[model samples]
Target chain A: MSLTPSKRAYVPFVSVEHMMGLVHHIGIEQVLTDLASEIEADFRRWPLFDKTPRVASHSDVGVIELMPTSDGETYGFKYVNGHPKNTAEGLQTVTAFGLLAEVDSGYPTLLSEMTLLTALRTAATSAMAAKHLAPKGARTMAMIGNGAQSEFQCLAFKAVCGIDTVRLYDIDTSATTRCAGNLAANGLTVVECRSGQEAMEGAQIITTCTADKQYATILTDNMVGSGVHINAIGGDCPGKTELHRDILLRSSIFVEYPPQTRVEGEIQQLEHDHAVTELWKVIEGQVSGRTDDRQITLFDSVGFAIEDFSALRYIAKAVKGTPFFTELDMIADPDDPRDLFGMFQRAKS
Target chain B: MSLTPSKRAYVPFVSVEHMMGLVHHIGIEQVLTDLASEIEADFRRWPLFDKTPRVASHSDVGVIELMPTSDGETYGFKYVNGHPKNTAEGLQTVTAFGLLAEVDSGYPTLLSEMTLLTALRTAATSAMAAKHLAPKGARTMAMIGNGAQSEFQCLAFKAVCGIDTVRLYDIDTSATTRCAGNLAANGLTVVECRSGQEAMEGAQIITTCTADKQYATILTDNMVGSGVHINAIGGDCPGKTELHRDILLRSSIFVEYPPQTRVEGEIQQLEHDHAVTELWKVIEGQVSGRTDDRQITLFDSVGFAIEDFSALRYIAKAVKGTPFFTELDMIADPDDPRDLFGMFQRAKS
Candidate 1:
């Protein structure tokens, strides 16, 4: 039977540039601040999530991953690729996009680029951990990996935890120079450190976002002082790590989804029973965070799907007033659900 | 450090019509034949592949699914949705797309629409199963549920089996008329039948593809005669069944992935040890398909990822020599795998 002529179809989409414009339009400071709050809020209600470790398809050159998580009512997943050797071939090592769909109908509500969103969430997650686990009155941060993620980290700390200065260091001097140029003398007292050791000195928060797809000790125990909160961002897959073993042992480590962290985050080198605290437990008052001010603390940040969920949720809200977004023909909208084949003739494209 | 000049930026996407046009240009008959060969080849080496039950996300009105499979060097996943009630609202009951990527790089090499491809593969899979299972010299066929896929079923049988005529029936008379008209003046003889019983008279191959998403006894024991080959296609999800318990009891059952078939196929109504054979065994010559000419053979067909993989593989070959296709920006071309952010600025989307 022919489908009725009157029908409605929706193509909901948000492009990369439109999403970035929305971030700028709403002020990055406010965005990061709110993002941390959303992450923290979602984490506190952690029991609501159906948590499964990400399903990863690893390769010799890199890894492509699908991270799916649901809070029973909403389902979300991110399709991301991490190819460390891509930069040599003029490609970005990490590129991502994700979808947020309704659990009841499985209809995609928002499909958007997550490359920029990922940067925002990583920074937000780091700051969210710092807020619960870092010592009060922490004012400075040591950004060890001054690459694409540096600007977002600097801004996240500034907007969320009142950090006013950042000391940056990278193996490439050009990366450090470029990071500083993007900062453009904006508020934070930028110090271009010659080494990771130099960057960690006299810092309250140490954030590492290095991109090597190998086991790298970006921070050794000697470089990290007592009471410093290490926000280890890189070393996010198997056969990759950032902080040295001794550093992890000494600090009271707090992590997001410990099971996943043990495989992809800095804690991968440690034992299964190596006592660690979940950040959500502390945020929800289920467990204590930063029990002693002088105690060294660490946030083993392996990116989680929920943070991306929160990031997508935040973007949908922040970009509400903008007309920069365009829709993609992702879902089939037919005149009659039973007659799917009729769709081909109705929508020729 | 600006990534403004990175050479790893690309956005090549083939639209929906281009894919269909490519399929049409390649000729439908060739795709079916090549797909049959691919399915047969994959089924033979079934043990080498890592197979898992499909992960389904069900909803009130439909289900969105991700069927993932890999063979060490390549990874493929299909995103498909089945909404039987969608046509009432002018939406497709099913819409699908999938990706094929290199296992070494986790980079997607091909991204193609699977809505049409699915129709082709489903029919090809049925015919492939019938080749080994159906009794000798099966000519006339009874096709239950004449919808969009009716034409493919008729053609695949004519090509794979030596079927000379089709006896069709549908609850909706218009659908039956459409099927008859499409088959008219095209090689095979077409006849309209008043009921499922009427369609099965003298027909050796009885295909049941009714769209009711529930337990339906479309084929009763009395209607299913000796030497009848039942191709049950529509009973593909949980709570969906087509054959009566008695029909299944008297017939020899065959399936694709027993674990999944237990939940989604016609055997969902049967006991755990109902004694079904995997189609791979038959294709590989490891097991006997049909023992006697008078024995009732039933193929409880639930489409699998490998079949989709076979179809996608076949399509890639079919379009290899033609310039009728375009590529999607499914993967990034980064000079430095770490500089994914810089490529966004250069994407020219």
Candidate 2:
């Protein structure tokens, strides 16, 4: 027997392989550039969104979180887990998936593997922030703590901010080597460095994305120059930070959302009432980004739900005419909604 | 190019059809009985589980909720939506899907359609509660508001509490006809009634499972007898209830997870600190169920996440050696955990 799923029964699902295929088909650099544009568009209309801090459940090993947001028309949420020790057991430290649904019906429209999309969106957001805060003609980036996200960050900078060189460093030299090898055939020149200080030498932009779960100083106040933009991604959860406190004291800090950043970003080390600039204000031209070339600036990003929402929307639109998604029969739609029992009885026959 | 998903990438997915097939294969009544046993076992070990009020996002039309819970070893969550007006437009008023994950790694193990499973578990849970709370030798159940959930409630009572007769009533006569027609082949004798009062005549157990989203009462205080057990299922959200407050005043109310039931269950109409017994305590033998034939008992159930967790675990275990599930390549697993960039790059070839 064969069954034809009704329109409501099928939801478009982009698996990991199909997500990779879509990324490659769209050209990774082009996709990153497009994502940055999409994110910027949403950020410009930030006040229209319904935002909330992620709902998290933490255990001794790691934390699982659900981040949800809506723009009145569509709803989206990402289910992600962070387990730093998972890599030691041959597992990814983070895995994620997301769904987009219609606000009118509350039915899921698309379900996609978001591990790859997250990497892309995080990079795009960092580059988008740097585009407004970085020094003019910034061409080189110092990528500290080379890990799974390093290459995507490097390429996003090259695509969005015109960065042509990336100097990489990690405590584990093998990670730096892996990152360099992955970027070998990509357009940018990759520089390997023995220390964070060496990697920071003569770079106009600095990115730190280490995976340690505790407070660790990847950059001291002395290592950071005054004229560069800093992208901080690793110090995301409570008690986790990358840059030394002294550096934050000197830089003009900007954050995605203050309530969430106060708990999960580098600002957690500071007082609750400490003044910080909202990133959307700069994007909206309500505040100045970099008044002088010698002034330091930092983007304290703890990934937000809006970015994931934008990425899901981007993928849902990108895969429309492409064969990169499969329709999964996920919803139970009966011919007569009140006859759900009859639907099951007929299915038995 | 062909891609073979590794074990880490594959998450077991049970679609709606597959879930129906699994239910039929296991026999509907037997599945209900097994689900009740599983739920009871979990209730016995209740203190070992982490519980929280469901995270809900409400809109003008409906509400979408994420209900999450975790034992020390496994984590589970259900994504469910409720839109009362959906049935008028030929859509199920409630649709759901759920995920179960490994707590240590925070990776999803199973993804299953929970619409059918939810009906099964909700009925199973109701019957489980009735088994302890209902009067001895209670063989008749008056089912008010015969809609999607009516048949399941009837069958579950038959299998779990030895209920042999069901008297059905609905505001829509067609709904009552549909429900009674569906139950015609089942082992129980079905009686059609024109009004709720007619259905309640000579019934030992009264079940109200209406779907209206208002403060309307289907049963009045004078309509209920002193010795009957009332299974109230439809007053599951704020401003939606089936029983008048006077009936609640005379009964010993049992609830699941007081923190949640206080807001969404029938008890929302009561005071903040209104005394109610936790159903787990009754199952643990700490509290009395039906102390005497003259005492009134009420199972005021607003579904909890632990029940969904148990249902997911049961499905994950039941379809072990069966063809009732499909593997979904949902997680992106790099060969080397830190080389996620390399994995994406290699997938391009």
Candidate 3:
């Protein structure tokens, strides 16, 4: 018997190196623009996908989550972890990887390192939401929390929403300086501010992407003005909200999946029975987005599985015939599928 | 800056070829025996694990499941899929991979192909349960379905429980012939039987591991004699079972995790409130295993997450300092955790 693995036994793997190469080859801004459109398209047909709240295993120091979804023809899931303390040890606060499989054979088609992909997708998702909810003619964004995700968010908004300027702030000035330096050559006018209040000046959009696992308020009610869209992406776990209660009550809230947002999003700060529109409904034109120019629209942005699914789907296509992936013998396929032991015995030779 | 991945950025990956090499180097019987011991040790301290039913995505053609568990220090999860139609397409009916991460940092430390490891662990878990539940001096086991898992089950029982003989039978004579051939020189007295009743004639233990996604009786109630230990492993999904309902009623049933078993095991044929002993409880001495020699005992084995976790822990140790794994740059680690965008820019050269 031939010992070479069959095509069925190989899965295409995109490592961090390959992902970076793919991103740069496709151009980050172009990739982000395409990802936003792909996410918007998936959101348009959201009801066709199977949606469930992520399965999370929370520890005292961190949390690990598995977010899975399928669109009838394909299945996808992402394994991600959030450990705020990891940065102190020179590691990322979040790391991730994901898989895509064919629903027909239950075989994996793609496995990719999702740390970089997640960064791209999360920013694309934020920019996509803002495109629908942010006030028309909005060209400036207040980016509070100039940490790892700041530059990506700034660039995605520039690419997807036509925002040309970003006002950046963080509790640590070093992070703000780092963010400002990264955007210097990206064509975005970046202003580094000392405080959260200073970051909001002359900005039509507010994006909060802090990393504290607490209830500290990054945006008080008085700081958020009317007619600006708020993308609260940091308050993703219970007891870690970013917006104040008053700001939540005043805003017209929208969320990805209500069952998950009620537990993990900024809406968790609101009453359990508070009204929130599903983002897909608005994207599909079944519900209105930004009904009035002066309306306070809050996209309570806790990440969802479908967004990762969209990213997986996009990467699976984008890497085709490109030198952005290598094959791994991750699956075992015997000539006679039922004789797995015979295959094992033959390998003993 | 060095382009080489830092230690934290690398995760050890065990592929199919490496897994086979490791198994052959360590000997399959030794690996099975070691896996059984590891499973037992974990079952002895089962309460420390954070357990949940597998998150399953069911499609018309198949099911994909994520099984996750943590023991405070480490977290592990397995991604497995079952598509019976896959065999017809010259693919394995089941395929799997797993990950292990440190709970403190939530960083994935290991990624291993589990399609083969899963078969090993399942048999090990079965043999471990039979060691506690099987009658004293049980020398012969009737392996009713000679599929991919049959040889592993036979060898595991031989190594862990000292069963010197296995009676094999399958509806397909070729399968039975193949199974007998595989076990020929394995130090077991292999008997080829024409029927399930003939296989059970002189056996005190019976293991059923068929692969049909339906409710079909491979063993009738009248065929099962008193005082025999039954390992029912084939009835793993909803609407799939092997034994007659009357046989399940006559046996003193034990299960891995009741919540999962009630939905996916032979006990699904029974009432939702049926009393069944947990195998871990028996291993922990919190409950009894087999009360008398004349009382039928059934291990209704629907696999659980902790078993996979135990196997992961085992492989993580076994592959250390060995040529069984390769490091993949799966995690993106920047020099400064907050300077991820800077890392991207630096990689451009």
Which prediction has the highest TM-score against the true structure? 3
iRMSD (Å), candidate 1: 4.0
lDDT, residue B241, candidate 2:
86
Q: What is the lDDT of residue A263 in candidate 3?
A: 97
Clashing residue pairs in candidate 2, if any? none
- Model 3, which residues run further than 4 Å from truth? none
Ranking by DockQ: 3, 2, 1
For model 1, the local distance difference test gives 0.77
Candidate 1 TM-score, true structure as reference: 0.88
**lDDT (Cα, tens digit) per residue for candidate 1, span B1-349:** 3433322233233345555566566555666767788888989889877677776767677787778787777777777778777555555567676667666655556656676778888888998888888878989999999976787888888878889999999988988887787677558989899998999988989999987788888888888889888999999999999899998899899999999999999998889888999989988888988999889999999899888887776666666667745633333333444444444333432
Instruction: List DockQ, one per candidate, in order.
Output: 0.38, 0.85, 0.86
**Candidate 2 residues A34-121, lDDT tens each?**
9999999999999999898998888888989889999988989999999999999989999999998887777889999999899999
lDDT of 3 by residue, B4-66 (tens): 678999999999989888999999999999999999999999999999999999988789999
| Runs off by more than 4 Å, candidate 2 | A1-3, B1-3
Candidate 2 lDDT at B156 equals 94
For DockQ, the strongest prediction is 3
Write one digit per residue (lDDT tens) for candidate 1, span A216-259: 98887788778878888897899899888998889898888888
